[model samples]
Target chain A: MAGTDTSKEFMFRPTPAIVLCEPQLGENIGTTARAMANFGLWDLRLVNPRDGWPNEKAVAAAAKALPVIERVRVFDTLAEAIDDLNLVYATTARNREMFKPVIGPDEAADRMSAHIGAGQKAGILFGREKWGLNNDEVALSDAIVTLPVEPAFASLNIAQAVLVLAYEWRRAALKDAPLPFAGDEGEPAPRGQIVGLTEQLGEALDRAGFFKTDAKRPTVMNNIRAMFARAGFNAQEVRTLRGVVAALDRRHERPNPARLRKNDDEQ
Target chain B: MAGTDTSKEFMFRPTPAIVLCEPQLGENIGTTARAMANFGLWDLRLVNPRDGWPNEKAVAAAAKALPVIERVRVFDTLAEAIDDLNLVYATTARNREMFKPVIGPDEAADRMSAHIGAGQKAGILFGREKWGLNNDEVALSDAIVTLPVEPAFASLNIAQAVLVLAYEWRRAALKDAPLPFAGDEGEPAPRGQIVGLTEQLGEALDRAGFFKTDAKRPTVMNNIRAMFARAGFNAQEVRTLRGVVAALDRRHERPNPARLRKNDDEQ
Candidate 1:
């Protein structure tokens, strides 16, 4: 897909607004914007940046993701930043025992997708660089999203947190199921047809006396069947194997009286 | 393994040492130390810090990685930092036309491990915050480690750079052989033992008249051999399978034709 087209279709889908409340440093803000850009999330709302609006350092630090910072909306308060969002998820490392249900990044992403699809604007609020969101700030959100980090050191950089959440969100939004059997997008043959083909192949082998020497004939045959089943052979693959076996059988139809001698020599 | 014992055994094991050249901020140094810890590398040499040695900010920023900082040795200059090192690699975004090879972090890690195994002390030099190592400093190394970032914005924070290189180094150092098959450390059973076991199993099957169908003879036999081979059966595993086969054969010695038919039906 072309970059612009891919962006437009999923671009600016704007499932969640990233609200940075009183961000301390320009470099961190820039990195956070860059992280947002990774998941195609560009709608950023800044609440009282320390270095002032349109900070040069933030823009410089954004690197390839400067577009995200350029398009960010400046707001005076966290409430103003998330005013248009219907569903808000406040991110924090602290376990405050807020009555709201807590979820991980992936789960939050899944919920975010459903909410956005239902035409609701969702927002994720990030606290300042040093201390995370305050009690009042976290209480304002509909739910809380907490990342699982080492209990001894649960603190994560603001940008790293944004990146983790964005990655999960993008994966959920862009996932597609793998194709079955035939390869690519080909239609999968029915299970009954595949099993029937296996039986046909087995019978042909039986008529050729392939199971003569093996004492645990049933176990050996079952194992063979399991192998074919694991391969998930479609109708065509089974037919191909059968044809090759049939051809071989016809070639070896005339049994030699010296077959037992030849078998010993081969061993 | 006990951490200290494992650490001691591999203490002198050669690794790529990270040398920060006059790093200004303690937080960056702390983060860099944290990155080094991630890759199981504890050797850190700091070239004169602007804020002086053992900054509290660095310790706080390093968080749980204070042990790394505790062991860090401060130096007066780049030469002093790497005087004892046999191979030195300096990181730079600039593509210098010097004769030394320029490699990515992964490649550098691989090379470092190989050299380290040969008992060579390898070091990587990282420049300061404002102005990276001057040309003189860059010229002090054997090779340059550069992260492939966008050409428009290639500058990465010192700690972030350390994180990437450290990650790649640890991955290379700990790379193990594919599993289920024991690696080089474990002794494999002799080939004769495996073959003898297969033959015993095959003889038991032959006595049970498993090779009844002529056409299936080769396929069935070959499949049986392949199944055992894929299981990577050791001498013990082969003996166990043989015992199971013998027991089954003993039970079915009377060979009720109806029972045989039922076994086929079960399959």
Candidate 2:
């Protein structure tokens, strides 16, 4: 995907398998599938779906993500679901008080990437729709995947939970994922241009008697230079600023230029 | 509200105005509210929902989220919807030709948090569920919030988009959301303790002739010391490691002390 107004293509990569542990609603499953597809995640394993397999409702809600829905795997238990996976992360917001390593989605994604890079199968286990993965379920996994959601409302909809994890996985796994960016408006000011601009401004300030306290002159001048540096001046911007400085520094003429010239002539 | 299974309360904050531009489905709106509420976001505005307001279907899908649903506002147009907001981010995946800055949801959330902190209102505009915001609508926004969704399936459902933005906003606002944490099992080793450990290890290593090349002894020892520094060894860990080193270096109590005495007597 190309970010807005840029030619850079965001490359897709192999992502971790998504395992839903006894998900209840067909609609939630559908939305979760859609979320995964959004981030290029295809492998989906379902552990004992409440309503049963080949759910038409889920397929309908999935809309354009039939490919994921069609290839969905059904397992009777969590162990069977993740048996093939070398590393599994249990997704839960509940503080189970178990002595398990808890990690945010980004770190999990990074670890998963490393595992996958080593040709090891990796997957993330999303808990039930209602209560989430139980303590036992959480204990079985290598790490606990949690988001810093609001404590008052930590109950993220299953699909949203999937989306957040999937998004982070995309951010970490896909090195070339197009990040939102603004194209540069103009060329950066060259060293010569910046030096010229700085000197011209310094000269103008000198004429204005800006450095009245000569003791602090260097500090003030340095501050002005730092301000310009932070402004990210382009070549054109530098030229324009220099022109403004020159105009302000221009010595004033008499009321009438011709009359002033005549007066000078008489003098 | 307390996070799942945690005593810590998730404090609510004033978030950006969530403006949905001509959303088609009532269910999607309900899900959007659910997503927003998951992250403590409450402000929701709709511009010309295809089905009229007070939709039963939307409320049903909201899953008992009446607080956010009840306070939802309706507008006739996009301009009216965001007129009260100071900064606006138009959520779009399209590469529209515009000079506006394009930022990801994380940066947008950061900017929104900063704007709201300064008492300036900010809002994010979500286009229709189908075609997304038109060029004119996108042009009016101060910036574009785009996600790197899979190009094959770039159409992220409206609720998914809202949840992503809301998630990021929550992440920015709640500085205390338990991030990925490495639970330190023991306290950091004090400088004095580390120095002692380093010297002890160095002596034992020296006795064992670890530094074979005299010229590289200092460099090798320094490298070993730096490795420990990088390990971030806690006090307990350092002590345990020291015990291991002492066990490995048990060169005293000659293995044949008792055996040799018994053998000498037998002789």
* Candidate 1 per-residue lDDT over residues B1-267, each given as its tens digit: 001112222232346789999999999999888666644678999999999887999988885675478889999988898999988888876655554556766678899888888888898888888767777887898777765432333446787667666656755675652211111212234667667766777777777788887688778778877776765665655667678777777776667778889999999
Candidate 2's error at B35, in angstroms? 0.7
TM-score of each: 0.41, 0.66
lDDT of each residue in A158-204, candidate 2, tens digit only: 78888998887876776565654443336668877887888898877
Predicted chain A of candidate 1: TM-score: 0.64
Pairs that clash in candidate 2? A151-B1, A151-B2, A151-B3, A152-B1
lDDT of 1 by residue, A1-267 (tens): 001112223246554788999998999889988767755677888998887888988888786575587788889888888888988998876666545567766578889888887888988989987777888998898777765432223446788677666655654565442111111212335677666766776777777787776576777778877887776565666667778766766656765558868998999
lDDT of 2 by residue, B1-267 (tens): 124424645344678889998888999899888888777788899999999898888999886555579889999988898888989999888767565567888789889989998989999998887788888998778888888676666667788888888888877776555652343235568877777788888888877888887898889778878888877778877888889777666764345477778999999
> C-alpha displacement of A51 in model 1, angstroms?
16
Candidate 2: list runs displaced more than 4 Å.
A1-12, A179-267, B1-12, B179-267
Candidate 2 residue-wise lDDT at A11: 36
Model 1, residue A137: what's the lDDT? 93
